[model samples]
Target chain A: MKIRESSALILPPYFFLTVFFILPVLIILILSFTHNRDWSQGITLKNYLLILDPLYLKVLIRSLIFAVLATLGSLLIGLPMAYYISFSNPKRKILLTLLVLVPFWTNFLVRIFAWFTILGRQGLINSFLLWSGIINEPLQLLHTSGAVVLGLVYGEIPFMILPIIAAMDRMDISLLEAATNLGANRFMVFKKLVLPLASPGIIAGSIFVFIPALGSFVVPDILGGRDSFMIGNTIKNQFMTVRDWSFGSSLSIILMVLVLLGVSAYLRQGRDQSMTLGEYL
Target chain B: MSHRDATSNVGFGQGKSVSIVTISGLVFLYLPIFILIVYSFNDSRFSASWNGFSFKWYKIMWHDGPLWTAIKNTLIIATANTLVSTFLGTLAALALSRHRYRFMGVYHKILHMPIVIPDVVQAVSLLMLFAFFHFTLGLVSVILAHASFSISFVALVVMAKLSNLDRRLEEAAMDLGANRFQVLTQVILPNIWPGILAGGLLAFTLSIDDFVITFFTSGVGSTTLPLKIYSMIKFGITPEINAISTVLVLFSTLAVSSIHLFDREKK
Candidate 1:
């Protein structure tokens, strides 16, 4: 009786996901192999072969580099930020964590655009530098690869910080007490005990930041110059500008595969931790 | 790495260097937003540089017809997205938390697919889907696109909340001669009310802030705020965009504060 009832409850979402999510993705998979939108030309590897061009290969490499840079930058900042909040007094911890999270609630376009107030030619940094006679010309900062990485880091750092804090919260004070009681110094306790305990969050954080950075479109489109094109820009241009639906679908498939690879790695890591870290970004 | 002994106070690495990194790290996160908000009131039209304060941009953004149309479109879509996803997600959450079934493991993995996949991938796939069916690229399509991703998130969050629920309450209610429907409606529903709200709020936010999906799914006359803002920014940065951005940032702050307050009150 209960089984039947549970089936009834699950049916709505199951049907919804089937029609909207699963079916759509599957349709695209078949569409990727075809010559045109209607598939009148039949299945072909022509679309996939087109992806082998050196130019497309270079875009993939550039995309990986950007993703790696942003992930590393986030880790460097998130670790200390997480530690400071984790170690604070209970009263202050909540407020401190809140500060780290407020930016996330904003639309990402707004967050990325905020950099304009600081990085644009007539913006804060240049204005200050020009006033002080530090440089005769305003530096070109906005339309550069560096700015894209910077935006990616600034855009997604909160995802990295929050997970590490969760891991830190899971740390038992008794473990620290036991380690110190066993003749370990403070640094030793931190290096051996705290760091190891925080590994899961660090892994989760890396996956969280890395996946989005890998597929980043807006940051590059807005902040990056022509030379800084990532795979996302290529995929978008294919569909939106080039009107090449077949190639766009194939490119989308490849990007999805790459993202799925990262997710599988994350899921493997998550086995020990389970679904606690599964909050969708 | 220097000034190590400074961590001796409270012993959680409250070192001078740690404090510097942490505080500066926070400044990195917040200072751009601080500047963005400040620039919204600037008198200058094109440059971000201050030319004293004014509300001229706010006046312009207020009267901007296209901007209002986008905002209205966003509201309609977000509301529809939230309502449908929350209902379906709440049911799925209850099913996952309260029952065991065949192929549950596979079901769980598939559920995570929408969550883990990049937005661009999801967006293009849905575009293909709608195109294949000759579906009109408009508000309905955008709502479907947003809800596809939001449903998984809503399920996950509500599932998290449902995990801690006491099954005994439902059982006891059933033992009192109540039917399964009565037990669920009277007992299980109240217990997971917060989860539903959180999931609904989350769905609303995801729909509102979404750009990639909306970018693909929306057609003429179906622009959302993010898409409108994107078109504006591409042209150039103006105090008008800054005003719109400031309002967005303010919404974020309000959301964070309310969540904080709600959490405290519940506790």
Candidate 2:
């Protein structure tokens, strides 16, 4: 009786996901191997082969590089802040954590757009420099690889911070004291004790930041120049502008596989921590 | 506990530099938003320059018909998606948490797939599905797509809550002659109400803020706020966009903060 009741309860979402979510992805997998203009031409490796060209390969490499840099940038900025918050009093901890989340609450597009006014040729930074007589000409700050990295790092830092803070909250502080009492300096203590203990958080946070950065379209679209085009841009163009669904589907599949690898790493780390999937998010 | 204090003191000794990093991190996070809000009141049309204070952009946004249409569409979709996904997800969570069954592990993994998949992949696949099925790309398709991904999130939240639930309450209610339906409605539902509410708010926020999936699934007339903003930003930055974005930012902040506060209170 209990089993039947449970099945009844689960059936709705099971059916919903199978129909709308799982089935769609399966269709995309099938579609990627077929001809774009005419499906009747049957399955072929053309779409996947096309993605192997050096031009497309460069975009894929650029995406990976950008994602790695963004992940590292977020870690550099987030670790200290999360460390501070972890040691804060309860009242201050909540407040500081909320501060981290405030930017995330804003529309992602708006946050990226804010960079435009700050980085454009005639924008805030340039105008201020020119007014202070620091430079005779407005520097090109927008539409560059550096600008894209900055935007991505800014956008993803909170994800990195939150998990690290959660991990730190659960840490055994006595281990830190033992390290200190044994005459290990702060840097040595962090390297030997804190860093090893927080590896799970670091891995989880990296997956969170890196996967999104890899698949990000809007950030690059807004802040990146032509030379900074990532695989996401290539995929977007394939679908929207080029009107090649087969090629787009193939690109999407490749990206999905990469994301799944990151997610599996996250899941493994999560298993060690006994964390629910929701907690990782 | 004394050892903990000793370690925390070590942390406190570095407080000066830590505070600097924290303060600067806060500034980095908010500077763009602060600039955007301040520049929304500028009399200039271009966002980069500030002539003087004015509410011209606000007035312009007030009269922007397409913007209003997008807002309406977004709210309608978000509301519908939230209601449907939350209901379905809560049911699934109850099933997963309250009962043990064969293939339960596989079921859990399947449910988590949507949460991990990239939005672009999900978007393109949904677009393909719609084309394959001859489903018109419109408000309905967008709502379906949003709900499809959002159900997983809702289930996850509710499952987390349900896992910690005291099953004794339901058993006690049943011992007091309550039927299964009454035990569920009176005992389980009230217990998990906060999770349901949080999941609903999350779904609504995600549906409202969704861009990638909506971009592909939305038809010519069913643009959402994010979609509208994307098209506008693609052209160029304007004070009008700043004003609209300020409103969106304010709304989302309120929504997300309320969820945070709600969860805190439950804890």
Each candidate's TM vs. the true structure?
0.95, 0.94
The lowest-lDDT stretch of 10 consecutive residues in candidate 1 chain A is A272-281
Lowest lDDT block of 10, candidate 2 chain A: A1-10
Give per-residue lDDT, candidate 2, residue A177.
74
lDDT of 2 by residue, A187-230 (tens): 78777877777777777787779988999888898899899988
Distance (Å) between predicted and true CA of B259, model 1? 1.6
Report the lDDT tens digits of candidate 1 across residue range B183-251.
879998888898889889999999999999999999988999999999999986678988998888777
Give the top-scoring candidate (TM-score): 1
Every candidate's DockQ is: 0.52, 0.60
TM-score of 1: 0.95
Extract clashing residue pairs from model 1. Answer: none
Clashes of 1: 0
Candidate 2 chain B: worst-modelled 10 consecutive residues by lDDT: B1-10
Query: Model 2, B224: alpha-carbon shift in Å?
Result: 0.7
